[model samples]
Target: MILIAKIVSIDCNLKCDYCFYHRWNQNSNRLMSCGTLETLIKEGCDYSPICAQFIWHGGEPLLAGLKFFEKIIEFQNKYRKNGQNIVNKIQTNGTLINEEWAKFFHSNQFGVGISLDGPKNLHNTFRKYPDSDGSFDATWQGIQILRQNGIIPGIIAVINSANVIFPQEMFEFFIDSELKNLVFNPAMIKDDISGLPTGIVAKPTDYGNFINRIFDLWLKKDDPKIEIRQIKSVVHALIGGKYRSCRFKSECQKYPTIECNGDIFSCDGDEQNKNIRFGNIRQGLNHIFSSEIYKEYRRKIQRLRISCLDCQWYKICRGGCTRDYCSRSQELPKNYFCEGMKEVYQHISDSLKYYKILPL
Candidate 1:
């Protein structure tokens, strides 16, 4: 079981236009308390069967300061059970990463991922500081520092209007920067009250085309080391393996996201949705996971719609993310990105068949 900990809450330095977190009131600068952190690590370590994976998510996790992470390492080592592997990963904007930070990540063996949309112009279009200054230069410099420290950080670029139009360029940007590990998240911002996707979200067709371009570029490459998370997941699914992404899982399960105040939500995508909350760490992981509320929530999310069940790619795409559904109904949900998902999956499947990875 992986824990997605929003350690610093929604207190980010950069104001990206399409960020879903922007819908919530982020005036409060709440940091996860020491007591909460200790309990989380202890309980999380106890609960995880083999590996206790902690994904340090943000509103800029680095905003919590380096000392907070040092304490996290201490707590993990203290509470780690015999033969239980502890893994830590952080996703950051990369503006704050200096030589010291890079060295620390490398020394600790932390899996680092940076949020960069693309090259300077495309990245700067939507990702900017409060003063409206573009963040590409600082972020790029941070990437350089990490590389100098012998850490090739993963690039997590958001697919929006700015970068989506230039898929080949975006792919080249990463290759040029020597950032082989990549994850492209489509810009999908949902309306708070209505639960309908709105505002600067990439159109289904646009996203599908963008992904196709990247896939073509990827296939032409001589390097097998270049790993794109979405593409890898698709390829894995085509090879008769389960979709590695949470969004495309055959049955959606609880990969809980812990808020700064210790409240545990069902998924990172639906953190703001109050209905999926599985109580706090103070209640203990056993109590939270075993509670009737959590079970009911899980059941509700796992129910596949008739359309999804009838689809040929049910095993590959499942129903996609429930949160990305155009309608909020739990009984009969339809993903906003269904067309795009199908297009990409089909593209990958055909490619695999051509390469003789799949039987004709």
Candidate 2:
């Protein structure tokens, strides 16, 4: 299981228009206390059956400072069980990365994911600073620093309408920048605190075409150095590989996100809703596991929609993210991107046949 620690709360330096935290109005000055981190690590390690991955997320995890991670590494070593290993990963905006941060990450063998949309124009369209200044240059510089430190950072680009139209360009940019592992998150439209639709949500078909174009570009590469998680995940599962992506998982709520103050949420996307709060570290993992909310989430996952069950790509998609289904209706329904998912899957299967990457 994965435990996402929102250590720095909703304290980000850049204001990305499509950020879920921003739309939810999750502004906070809270930083995770050492005691909370200690308790969380101990509880997680003790309860995990095999291994636990702690994904440090935030407004921006680096905002918590280097000393915080130093102590976290120490605590991880101190509490880890003999057979159960603990892995740390951080998903950062890449603006705060420097030589010191890169060195520490490289030395610890930490998995790093950097957020970059594409080239300057596409990226800066949404990702901006407090003064409405573009952050593409700063972010790219951070990526370079990590590379110089001998760490290959994974790229996560959020797909909006503006960038979706330029999938080839995006793929080329990542290749040129030496980014290997990539993940594209389709921008979701959700009601903000004021009940207005927030961010530039990509049309379902546009997202499908965008990924298809990227797959075309990905297939044409002689080296095929880049690995897009969105495509690779489905391909891996279709070929009977054991994978753990929430998008293709039977239960999306298996991974719990713990807030800075120890408030546990079912999923990171569901953090804005107080109703999804199960139990905190103070209450113990057992208490959270036994809660009705958690049970209901599991139950919902098991009870797949008839439409989803009947769909050909059900196994690979698994009805997509549960949060996407329940965002507005307050109920777990069929995935909103059902058609788009089908299109992408069909495209992938066809490409695999043409390239002979998998058995037809």
Candidate 3:
């Protein structure tokens, strides 16, 4: 089954230092209305497979109210008779989570991921409410509510200079809190957008060192609950096809991303731009895969450039993340993710040698 992430709410309480969406307040978020959501889910279920994973992502999804999400679950459950299956997950900042939220989420068996930077010193360094109050206290309090309800929340740590030195500390915090299975994504910024540099532009070597540090802790630090950010791509590669796109195992696999408001994009992360958009939700899913817009996006993935074609790591890298490539560079030969992929590939290769998952 393919993974589908939807935006439940555009509203967010915190105005983080590097919020790429530039979210403002409760009103800023444009939530997915019930009509659009129903249509999308119904259409999405028509794929060959009966079971699918749905992830709720947003400026802050909880602001949409638990009732709205329940309605979605109910709708999907109704379609289960037709062999449609849906698994729920949410990516939130944890500010809105409380006893009620925890109960609903845990009872529903949703995988919840909270955005926390670590100790108060590091968390408050960049992540904060618009009023300039520190978010660590409120977020941790929310996490406490989840734990009380018997739901362990996974962490989504953005590696910034502010928190770079605290990776070990963060792992320790997770261990003490008894939370395991975390994702460590580096801070990402757009060239057109204004924000702090994404942790001082760590070159490949710096990233290699960072990976080594993480492995150091994972192997020797005695932190049983901690797992670094490798699940998504590694699992994807182990699974699918091979026409193109370095990101996916096979370009022919056709994992499409549907945006809120009836719009579709070639990919999820970089769909805001009109240029890359495919079709609207009103359109049937069948037509989108064959449309010119999709063809163009697919072609771009196939023919990235001479340099990309020649690179030894091109196939596995899948031309890197389009958002990171085009947004950070805004031009060719300057994908900011170049360094990151280099580090990831090298480390994974080294790791595989030790485990015999790849060539020695």
Best by lDDT: 1
Candidates 1 and 3, the one with greater lDDT: 1
- Which has the higher TM-score value, candidate number 1 or candidate number 2? 1
lDDT per residue as tens, model 1, 308-327: 88888888877877666666
- Candidate 3: TM-score? 0.82
Clashes of each: 0, 0, 6
Give candidate 3 regions above 4 Å deviation. 1-9, 23-26, 82-84, 193-205, 221-226, 231-257, 271-275, 326-333, 351-359
Which whole-number lDDT from 0 to 100 does residue 17 have in model 1?
Answer: 80
Candidates sorted by TM-score, best first: 1, 2, 3
Candidate 2 deviant stretches above 4 angstroms:
23-28, 193-199, 271-274, 302-306, 326-332, 355-360
> For residues 1-360, what per-residue lDDT tens digits would candidate 2 score against the true structure?
788999988889888887766654444657899999999998888888478788999889999999999999899889888887778899999999999999999999899999999999999999998688989999989998998999989888989978998988999888987887999988765664533334487777888899888888887885666778887787787777776467777666778889899988877764233367787889999888988988987775567555577788888887786655533445445566677878999988887777777787
What is each predicted model's overall lDDT from 0 to 1? 0.84, 0.82, 0.65
RMSD of candidate 2 to the truth, in angstroms, is 2.6
